[model samples]
Target: MDYYLLPIIAIVLGFLFLILAFYLALSNARRITKLGFINLILIAVVAIACGLLLMFVFTGDLANFV
Candidate 1:
């Protein structure tokens, strides 16, 4: 029931999703280009969201993970 756990989970899930997106983009398919483009957007959004969550967790009072 730690306060920081939620953000940490979010960050991990984002990374996993990113990996899946990459796999999709790299797979041999007719729409590889479209998948790659979508993956790019997914990467950007996940990165930004995780980064902001980390910053908020550490900079804000929720950093009290102890």
Candidate 2:
């Protein structure tokens, strides 16, 4: 395994999750609950934070991919 792989993977996967969450947020479903939206927001936030932290640990250079 490489030092860059884990954070890279986390960032890519996190982006995908973020996209999905945004899609869900954009969709209008009459029966959808507020809790579901909250969960999605949380997931997106945490995934993004986790990825960024990992990147920071591995690269120590923010705003650029590790």
Candidate 3:
């Protein structure tokens, strides 16, 4: 019900942002210099951190799930 909506929405948005970041990284890889690859990794790390933080805030039981 209503309780599930926030978590569901957060998950969907998290995935969308991750996908967008990955696609942007791929696109940049083709156009930018070799150093740009580092940016891609940074972006991925940040996305993962954000996703985990969101899950932690919403679920409050990260250890049990992961």
Largest lDDT belongs to which candidate? 2
- Determine which window of 10 residues in candidate 1 has minimal summed lDDT: 28-37
User: Compared with the true structure, what per-residue lDDT tens digits does model 2 show for residues 1-66?
Assistant: 886787777777777877776777678664446787777677777877887888787778654652
Model 2 stretches with alpha carbons more than 4 Å out: 61-66
Stretches > 4 Å off in candidate 1: 30-51, 54-66
Give the Cα RMSD of candidate 2.
4.7
The lDDT of model 2 is 0.73
What would the per-residue lDDT of candidate 1 be over residues 1-62, giving only the tens digit for each residue?
86556666766667776666677667755545785758765875776597677768777777
Clashing pairs in 3: none
RMSD of each: 4.5, 4.7, 5.8
lDDT of each: 0.69, 0.73, 0.60
What does candidate 2 score on TM? 0.66
Best by TM-score: 2
lDDT assessment of candidate 1: 0.69
* Higher-ranked by TM-score: 1 or 3: 1
The residue pairs found clashing in candidate 2 are none
Candidate scoring better on lDDT of 2 and 3: 2
**Every model's TM-score:** 0.54, 0.66, 0.45
